[model samples]
Target: MGYSVVKMKIGNSLEEDIRRIEAALEVVPSGKNLAVDANGRLDLETAIEYAKALEKYDLFWYEEAGDPLDFEIQAELAKHYKNPMATGENLFSMQDVRNLIRYGGMRKDIDYLQFDCALSYGLVEYLRTLKMLEEYGWSSRRCIPHGGHQMSLNIAAGLKLGGNESYPGIFEPFGGFADNIAVVDGYVGLPDIPGVGFETKAELMKVLRSVAE
Candidate 1:
C-alpha cells in the first residue's frame, strides 16, 4: 500500500495502546503520518488522558474519542488536545452535523471532518453538508469521507475533498477502487469509466448484477 497515513484503532487500554503506538512508530517512517481512531470508546477523563499521553507523537488526528453525539465531551477534549481531531462519521443528518459544528468546538484550521455520504443521506445531503461547512468558514478541503468505496471516492474527486479513506483488503470486492487503478505515493487516480466505475471491478459488478436480478 502506498498510503502516506496509517490509522489504527485505540481505546483498548492506555498501556496497550501506548505499546502499540510505540511499535507502530518504530516501523512507520518519519515522513509518513499516523492517526488513531478511538471509535468513541473513552469517557471524557480517559479521552483527555489518552490525548495528553499521545500528544508528543504528533498524530495526524485523534478520531472519535468519546460518543459521537456528545458535543460537550468533544468540546472539552479540544481544549486539552492541541492536535487535529476528526469525527462526524456517525453523524447522519445535516442537522446533526450542523450541531457538531455549532457546539463541538472543532477548529477549522487544524481539524478534519470525516462525514461519509453513503452512511448518512447520500450525495445530495453531503452537498448540503458541504454548503453548511462553507457557511461556517470551513473549507471543502477539510472534508474526508469515511467509507472506503467508489461512491465516496468519486465525491472526493468531484467535490475536491481532503481525501477519501481506503480499506484495501478489508471488505473484499466492495472496499477498494477500480482494478486498473493503483495508489502511488499516497495518491490514487480515479477511474475514467462512468457511474462511479463499479463496472471496473469484476467481483463488485457480479455482486451488483446478482442483486439486480
Candidate 2:
C-alpha cells in the first residue's frame, strides 16, 4: 500500500502495546508515519500513561483513548500529551462535536478530527460540521473522515479535507476507492465520474445493484 501513514489498534496492555508499536515501527519504512487507535478503551490514568510512554515514537496521532463522550479524560490527556490526537469518529451530531471542541481541550493547531459523515448523518450534516469547525477557527484540512469508503473519499476531495482513510484488501468490495485509481507515493487521485463515484468500484457496484434489485 502506498500510504504514508499506517494506523493500528492499541489498549490491549501497556507492555503489549509498546512491544507491538516497536515491532510495527521496525517494518514500516523510514519517513512514513504510524498512528494508534485505542477505540476509547483506556481509563484516564492508563491513557495518560500510554501517551507518556509512546511520545518518543512521534506518532501521527493517538486516537480515542477513552470514552468518546468523556471530555474530562480528553482534556486531562491533552495537558500531558503534546503530540497530535484524534477523535470524533463516534461523535454523531454537530452539537456533540461542538461540545468536544468546547470542552475536549483539543488543540486545533496540532490535533486532527475524524468525523465520518456516513457514520454521523450524511453529507449535509458534515457540511454543517465543517462550518462549525470554521467558526471555531479550525481548518477543514484537519479533518480525515473515518470510513474507508468512496463517499468520504469524494467528500475529502471536494472539501479539501486533510485526507481520507482507506482500507485496501479489507472489507471486500465496500472499503476501497475506484478500481482504476491507484495510490502512488501515499496519494491517490479521485475518480472522474460524477456523484460519489460508487459506480467506479465494480465489485461494490455489483453489491449495490443486487441489494437494489
Best by TM-score: 1
For residues 128-184, write the lDDT of model 2, one tens digit per residue. 999999999999999999989888888898899999899898887888888978898
Model 1: weakest 10-residue lDDT segment is: 25-34
Q: Scored by CA lDDT, what does every candidate get? A: 0.91, 0.91
Report the C-alpha displacement of residue 47, candidate 1, in angstroms: 0.2
TM-score to true structure, per model: 0.97, 0.96
Residue-wise C-alpha lDDT for candidate 1, range 115-154, written one tens digit per residue: 9968878788888999999999999999999988888898
lDDT of 2 at 87: 95
Q: In model 2, state the lDDT of residue 210.
A: 92
Q: Clashing residue pairs in candidate 2, if any?
A: none
